[model samples]
Target: MTEEQLQALLHEMTTAEKVGQLTQFAGAFYSEQEDSTPVTGRIEFPVEEDMIKESGSVLGVAGAMKLMGIQREHLKKSRLGIPLLFMADVINGFETIFPIPLGLGATWDPALIEELQTISAKEAASAGLHISFAPMADLVRDPRWGRVMESTGEDPLLNSLFAAATVRGLQGKDSLIANDRVGACVKHFAAYGLAEGGRDYNTVDLSERELRDKHLPAYKAALEAGVKLVMTAFNTVDSIPATANSTLLRDLLRGELQFDGVVISDFGAVQELIPHGVAENEAEAAKKALEAGVDIDMMSLSYAHSLASLIDEHMIDSTFIDEAVLRVLQLKNELGLFEDPYRGVSLEKEQTVVGHPSHLALAQTVAEKSMVLLKNENVLPLDKQTSVALIGPYADNQDLLGEWSIFGKTDQTTTLRQAVQKQYTHAIYAKGSQLYERDEELLKEAIAAMEQTDCLLLALGEGKDRSGEGRSRSSITLAPCQIELARLAKETGKPVIVALFNARPLDLTELEPYADAILECWHPGSEGAKAVVAILSGKVNPSGKLTMSFPRATGQIPVYYNAYQTGRPLPPGSNERFFSRYIDIPNEPLYPFGFGLSYTSFGYSNRSLSSAKWDGSGILTVSVDITNIGEVKGDEIVQLYIQDVVGEVVRPVKELKSFQKVSLSPGETKTVTFEISHDMLQYYHSDLTFASDPGQFRVYVNGSSVCEEENTLTFSLVKS
Candidate 1:
């Protein structure tokens, strides 16, 4: 349908019909299934059959046949015959589940993440999904927030790269409705990652400068990549609920950012305004959200129950309703729903495409790339013929897909024991301990298995329900029983290889000393066990790095490498007692961002700069030579960081500007160059303007954030 056709349909819609277009609900509302997974809220709202038929979109309802049936029923009753948009939280993979987004971030290869998203798009589209609420562009600094698993990382530059890559992969290059593609919705618009106390849906208080500098870049990056939708955060910004905050949705998002696409409320966030004390009732909530530029109310009765009444009472303008409905109709037209509501979704396609062998192979590849080698100590790449004791609750369990893998089938998950057994003849398994429970008999059995085996492979961490939305943890350390299980395995005088199956970064300080090697296998999806085994068997080298910092203690909850310089800095070599220093633990994290190890070592050498000074619009080239110093072929991620010695505002200690993932064989050396334009030096100044000032800068090229043996060069930015 053309613009004129969409506008005509909008013009003919009644206030009720228009309100319906701006409303979204779960499949239960349409009498689809009683056991239908509630996408947002837990309560069962009394949804009329007519409302379901006239509704603009449905959430969490996938499957070619089911979606076709819903479209068939919805189109028959829709007065304007606008087809319902099918959306779901396809955060990582669809059927052939990939690693969680955090693990994808750890891969540090945007191309790999893009391919994962492309596979996700194809699988999701075949299942009849039109939109994926994915690539959760929230920059998470606090690992206590359960949803950190969904974020790329705490760095704006890194998150932005991944965001744009995801948009391109999900929606394709030209059209959003192209072959095996679906619309990408970058989520939690503002600073949802900065929830107070690291709690989900908590208050967020950020200054405008901090908001723009830290949290807003990823969303803007997604928009610039042509993402079709934006979802509002669940938290309040500046004491105003995000769902109804015009300052966020209107002045900042639609105004400053120029995001012309639809703005959606995150999972009942619209009606949450009432509980947030910003709205007196549902009517007031509906009015504020619609007026504030929220184009859709997802999984809430606020719009359906009170939007029309607000317009009738002159509390909200009818034009607001018209504008929101027009965007919905426009999306429908863009999806080609007006012509073919099925959108090529079929049972045959679902059968052939959902879990295709190629997709499974890609999932395994991504899973392999995402496993971070935190510690090796010359005990990794366990021999395939070695007798191994795989002891853990996850040893034989199939719950490898982390939280938000709604479409994944657990029966398809290959457990660690199964993968090990398939590869070796002398692999024994036992349940060492539960995720949060301790059983003496289980520990005894595990100990016996360890004694009988050459080595112990212990898997431990939070369960599926512990590290997603609404699963924030006060303490992020391993459970006491799991730690005890690790201790018991170590007591057996066997080389212990601890493979973690967690979501967020765990406090591994307690368990680190007990392990000969540690692998941060962050819930590596359906083919997760296979990937872990391949890496352990030396078939795949560990190349993944940490995107988010792993704090040494929970006291250092918001630790990251790119922290701002303090006015009262700690004495460099004195270890002064009066400076800004933690009394117990050091200020630095246990593992810094971009920190990962491999079986093979890479050495950086010959750092050089094109010039000492660069004009405002000039480009400077920074080059470094990386040599594969170890005796194996491997991948190395070369990172470039810059520090503004003096700025209008306090700058980070060092900001990640550019990075390149290079692979080389033993004794191979390659020169990698990063072209640094003036734009790379720009920052949100004290006056809130984004530009670079005339100042000295220090550039460093290294393998990780804590670059002890870093190569540095000094340069300057000058006004032309």
Candidate 2:
């Protein structure tokens, strides 16, 4: 439908019908299905029967046949025959699950991430989902935020790149979503990641400069990449709930960022305005959200119960209601829903595409590349003939797909024991302890298996429920019982390898001492175990790197590599009490971002610059030679970091600028080059002006963020 036709349809909508277009409810409101996947919470508010037929969209409903049935029933009752838009929390994958977002971040390959999302979109779209509440662009600095697993990582540039890649992958590069693609909804509109105390749904307080400098980039990047929708955050921005904060949703998101797409509230966030102390009642909440530019109220009765009355009473303008409804209709037209309500949804397509072998193969490859070798002491790449003992709660557990994987089934997952047995015929298995508790009998069984094996591969870390929305942790260390198991295995005088199945960056300070090698194998999805065993058996080298910093202790909650330089800085080997340093623990993280080990060694040398000085318009070429110095072949992630020696405001010690992942055979060398332009040097100043200052800059190119002073090269940005 054209714009005029959409406006004509809006003209036919009654005040109640218009409000219904701006309202969304869970699938339960329309009908009940015995086989329906419970992906969302129960409907708390009473949804009137009339309102159900007029509702614009449905959430948390999948299965092509089920969606077709729901849409068919809804269209029969819909006065205008407006097709219902189907949305789901397809965060990682629909059925053929891939690694969680945190694991995808470790890959540091946006192109690969795009490919994964493309496959995810195909699976989800085949299941009749029109929009995916995904590509979570929140820039997280605290691992204690359970939703950190949904975010890419701490760096703005990296998160921004991945966010854009996710959008492009989901919706493709075209403005209109393809039949096999789903619309991308970049979520948590403002600074949801900066929740106070790293708590979920906690208050957020930050300076506008800090918010724009760090938190807003990724969301903006997603919008620039042509995301179809934007979801309001549950948290507040500048003390005002995001759903009703006009300054945030209207002035910032709509005005400055120019995101004119449908702005949907995150899961009853419209009604949450009352609990946030910003609204007195449902009417006030509806008025506030509508005035703040929210197009759809998801699972909230505020809009449905109060919008029509508010418009009739002239308390809120009808223009807001009409505008919102038009946006909804416009999106439906863009989705080609008017032409065919069941856009490409078919039971046959879903059956063939959901968990296809080719899709599973890609998931395995991504899971393998997503596993970071945090610590390896020449104990990895164990001979396939070695007697291996797979032990721990995750050994035979199928909860490999982490949080938000509502559609993924544990029965379809490959366990560590199963994968290990395929490679090591003499492999033994035992569950040392439950995920959160211990038993003496289980401990004895584990010890017996350990004694009979040459090496112990202990799978450990947070469960699938430990790190997603509302699953924050005050202490990120392993369970006490698991720690005891590690200590006992250490005393066995056998090499111990830990395969950590977690979502967020864990505090490994306690477990690091007992294990000879530590593999940060995040929730690796359906083929997680197979990918992990491939690395263990030397079939594939571990190439993943840390996107978020692993803190030495939970006290260092917000530790990151690109932190600001302090005035009273603690020098190396210093015992100064007055400096910006911790008394009990070092200020540095246990493992910095971009830090990861590989099966083979790599050497960086022959760093050179195209010019000693860079003018505003010219490109400066920075090049470095990376070689696989070890006997085995491997992949190296060449990271580029830059430091502005002087600036208008305080700058991070070093910011990640660019990265390239290169595959090299044994004794092969690859020259990686990066072209730095003036755009890369700009920063949000105190006055909010985005421009770079004329000053000296330091550039470092290496495998990781931490580099030696001797490796740093200097350059000057001359005045334009």
Candidate 3:
């Protein structure tokens, strides 16, 4: 339909019909139930039959035939025969799950991530899903926040790159909402990652400068990449709930960012305004959200029950409802739903594409590149003929798919023991202990297996349910029983290799002492086990890096690499008690960001600069020589970091500017070059001005964020 025809249809919509276009319900709302009451969060309210038919969209429902039945029935009662849009939380993958978003970030390969998301889009679109609430752009610095698994990491620049890549992958490079593609929704609008105490749904307090500099860039990148929709956060921004914050939604998101796309609330967030103390009742919640430019209310009745009456009572203008309804209609038309309601949904195609062998192969490659080698004391790359013992809660368990994989099944996932058996016929398996509990019989069996094998590969970490939405933890450490299991295995004097399967960064203080090698295998989706075996057998070298820093202890909750310099900063190896240093522990993380290990070592030498000064408008080229000095062929992620010597505000010690993944044969030498422009040095000032100042800068080129003095080069930025 043309814009004129959509406007004409909008003019024919009744007040109730317009409000219905702004309301969304879940799959269960359309099912027959004895209780006519519908629940949103904790509150239950009566939903009339007509309200169901008038709803603009449905959530948590999929499958080609099922959606066809719902849409066929819905159009019969829609009066104007408008088709309902189907949305789901297809965060990481649709059926053939990939590693959690954090693990994907560890690859430092946005091009690979784009390919993975394209496969995800194809699978999801085949299953009749029109929208995927994914590519979460929240900048997370705290590991205690369970939702960190959904984010790409803590750095704004890297997150922005991945966010844009995700959008392009899901929506297609041409921005066409084609039959094989699904529209992407960049989520949580603003800074939901900075929740205080790292608790889920907690308060977020930050300056507008902080919000703009560190948090808002990724969402803007997604929108700039042509995302079709935006989802509001469940938390507050500047003390106002994001769903009702006019400054955030209207001025920043829509006005300044120029996003004319559809805006929808997070699940039940509109009704949640009452508990947040921002609204007196549901009616007031509807008024505030609509005024704040929220277009659709998800799993909430506030819009359906109050919007028409608010317009009738002159409490709100009817234009708000009309404008929102038009956006909804426009999205449907853009999706080509008006022409073919099914939109190429076919059960045969869904079955053929989802979880296909090619898709699983890609998932395996991603999982292999995402597994970080945190510690290796000559215990990794085990000989294929070596006898190994696979023990712990995850030994034979199939909960390899991480949280937010709504469509992935555990039955389809391969377990560590199964993969080990396939790789090495001399391997034995035992369940040492439950995740959070101890059992003497299980311990004895595990110790027997450990004594019988030449090496111990302990599979341990939080369960699949431990990290995702609303699964925050006060202490981010392994359970005591699992720790004890590791201790007992170490007593046998066999080489202990810890393969950690988790979501967020964990406190490795307890388990670090006993392991000869530690592999941070984050919830590696369907082909995770196969990838792990391949790495262990020397078929694949570990090349993944840490995106989020691992805290030494739970006390270091919000630790990250790109922290601002402090006055009276503690000098390295200094014993001064008066400086800004922790008395109980060192301030450094257990594992810093961009830190990882490969089977082979690479040596850096001879750093050079094109010029000593940049005139602020031209590019300055920096180069360094990297050679594979070890005996094995491997891939290395060379990172480039910059430090602004002086600024209007305190700058980070070092910020990641660029990175490159290079494959090198043994004894091969390669020179990696980077071009730095004036825009790379810009920062948000006290007055919110984003520009670089004339100053001296230090550049470091190495394999990780921690750079040695010899690897650093000095340069200056002069006024144009």
In order of listing, the candidates' clash counts read 0, 0, 0
Q: List the candidates' TM-scores in order.
A: 0.98, 0.99, 0.98
Please list the residue runs of candidate 2 whose C-alpha ends up more than 4 Å from where it truly belongs after superposition. 34-43
> How much is the lDDT of residue 660 in candidate 1?
94
Report how far residue 204 has shifted in candidate 3, in Å. 0.5
- The sequence of per-residue lDDT tens digits that candidate 2 reaches over residues 1-720 is 889999999999888888888888887666666433345444455578988878899888788999999999989998889999999998888898999999999999899989989999999999999999989999999999999999899999999999999999999998778899999999998889989888998999888999988898899999999999999999988789999999998899889999889999998889989999999999999999999999999988999899888878899888888888998998999899999999978999999889999989999999999999999888998898899989999999999998988889879788998889999989999999999999999999998998999999999988977889888889898999899989999999999999999999989999999999999999999899999999998999999999999999999889999999888889888988899999999988999999999989999999999988878786899999999999888999999999998889988899999999999999999999998989889989999999999989999998889978899999999885
The local distance difference test score of model 1 is 0.88
Question: Candidate 2: TM-score?
Answer: 0.99
Which residue pairs in candidate 1 collide? none
Model 2 global lDDT (CA atoms, 0 to 1) = 0.91
lDDT of each: 0.88, 0.91, 0.91
Query: Candidate 1 lDDT, tens digit per residue, 601-700?
Result: 9988889999998885657999989999999999999999999999888889899999999999999999999989888888898789988879799998
